[model samples]
Target: MMDQPATSRTIDTQCVVAGSGPGGLMLGLLLARAGVDVTVVEKHADFLRDFRGDTVHPSTLDIIDQLGLLEELLKVPHTQAPRLHAEIGGRDVTIADFSRLPTKCRFIAFMPQWDFLDFLAREARKLPNFHIVMSAEVTDLIEDGGRIAGLVARTPDGSVEIRAPLVVGADGRNSVVRAKAGLEVESFGAPSDVLWMKLSHQPDDPPYTMGHGGPRQGFVMVDRGDYWQCGYVVRKGSFAEVKEKGIEAFREAVAAVSPLPADRVGEIRSWDEVHLLSIRIDRLKSWWRPGLLCIGDAAHAMSPIGGFGVNLAIQDAVAAANILSVPLREDRLADRYLAAVEKRRAFPTKATQKLQLMMQSSSKKRQESATKRSGPPSFVRGIARWPFLAHLTGRLVGLGIRSEKVNMAALKAR
Candidate 1:
């Protein structure tokens, strides 16, 4: 039955989770493991998209360990980072260090997001009650008597109505579920946008990862084994000016801050190869309405700083499963149960976003200042000066402000 495509006119499940992302799939997996019937719907046929967040922080690693899947997850090929490095005004400095985190794996595992998604799908499929419908785009919410009763998704064959008492919107930043649910978003503007492209790594390149930021420009280099996943930052809404400057100038800008050989920038032959991510920092005024709930990026969108987006989303999933699994299993799920998730996760979400906003604003100010040869930013230099500061930042980035642990009850449910 799992092999069959979603062609039925109506499907029933205890919980309907939209989007097959880290948050959605994790929530679906946890709920299913808790003996609840769960369905996760993905708009895409496969998780092969590039430039997605791939950083698996220690918080998530600890959660996997609690689930007893840490050994299995480590088998997948990935690069581990115990400490974060950055170049501030041409001077190298160590920033966050995850080595001291109180987790089974103290380092971040950088794996391609597609592989991670595939792994979750495989594990979830092992459960008899879990189902994932791919290429099924959610078109609208099925609202009944002022409460969300289910969702309507358009599949390859046709449309199908998934009925459930609770609908979990784990979709991404531009969430159709939240939009259809009439949730209001409070948008905090971003100062810059990012252009992501890949460049081949030379044998002689530095052995470790480093982030580069200069006057009015910033760059990032992630070691993707054979190549480097590079990101070039430009002032918000400046990509048009970048294009007008010609691809050669764009290549030069990338070469300016990065330690990689200038010749490697030529690999980015055209603008089409580059992906632009317009950074957004915002959260919904309310994460749930009646029978519907929004978690992950659907509830709040975080900045790319510290690679916290995916980790925070997974935190939401862990907390959701912990708070709602029991009530859901008892057929007593209520709006208060959904609201509890938001209440529990709201602090970490707000605190993380605040930190990102502060850093982004500070960076913008430094870039706009007349000081040309500034060393590391004051905070970063402080981190470099005080080793404990690095540990503190590491804990914040790796473990988050409030990390959720997997509930034993949920794990033992059968």
Candidate 2:
């Protein structure tokens, strides 16, 4: 036969999660572990992307412990950040001390986002009821009787239709599920965008540094064992201007604020190496409808401040599993059960976004003010002065406003 027509398939599950990000994968695992039939659809073939959020906070580590995957996760190559550091106002200061957190691992583990995703996928694959369909982009939501019933996904091979009682739009900020479902989003605009690139890490480099920015520039470089995952912040809608200035000029700007020597900055030899993350902070006006719910960035897009985005997304998955598992398994997934997930997560989401906005505002004001003083804001300076404040910052950054625990009831339901 010279050619043959591609085939189509239909899958039926109790819940279908779109997107294989932290939120989607974690939710699939939790639901499957609870004896709920679940499927996670991902548009990508592999989780090999660079410069995604890599900080796994203590809160997430505790959740992993609850799932009995902590030892395995810790076995992966990572850097432990018990104390977060930053260069503020030309002074290196310890910002958050995770050493005091009340968790099994009182530190933020700096692991590549790919490794983390792969770990979750691997663990989820071990579950009999957990199904992951990679390279399947969810194109549209399937509706019946005025409620979302399933979704249509397009794969390279053919078309795949997944039928489920609940559709989770964990597909991230530009979620097709949420868009198709006609959910309203309230945007809290971001002040800047980030240019992400990698620089070779030298043996003599600082062990663990977080941010390096001044009045004219903003940069964050996290130690990634052999390399530095760098993010250069530019004013919103300014990447074009940066490109017009040429790559050399951009490299100079990076060098100006980089803790690395000038030679290391040259690694960014071309514009292709720089990835621009157009930051957006927004949340859905409502996180759910009758038979569908949205979690993680699908519900609230978070700024990269504090590297809280990944942790918060995973938290949403945990909360979703806790609140909706039984309801979904028992065929009682009413609107209230979906709404309960939102109610459970809304406070921490709002509080985290508010804190990020406040920090962004403070940075913007400091950059615009005509004051001679050129250090971090007064509160940050106070944090440096008081050791206990670092602990407080650690709790806020590591544990979040309200960290979630895996509901044992959901786990035991299997």
* Highest TM-score model number: 1
Clashing pairs in 2: none
TM-score of 2: 0.96
Q: Per-residue lDDT for 1-414 in model 2, tens only?
A: 001111448888899999989999999999988889998888888888887888999999999999999999999999998998877766778889988788999999999989999999899888878888878888889999999999999888888888999999998889899999999999989878999999998898866658766564578888888889999888888999999999999999998887778778889989999999999999999999988999989999999868888989999999999988898888888888888889999999999999888888876777677265565555677887886899999999999999999998777965
Could you tell me how far off, in angstroms, the CA of residue 21 lies in candidate 1 after the best superposition? 0.6
For residues 200-246, write the lDDT of model 1, one tens digit per residue: 98889876676776567778888899999988888899999999999
Minimal lDDT window, size 10, model 1: 370-379
Q: State residue 24's C-alpha deviation in candidate 1, in Å.
A: 0.5
By lDDT, who's the top model here? 1
Badly placed stretches (over 4 Å) of model 1 are 1-4, 370-377
lDDT of each: 0.88, 0.87
Evaluated against the true structure, the overall lDDT of model 2 is 0.87
- Number of clashes recorded per candidate: 0, 0
RMSD of 1: 1.5
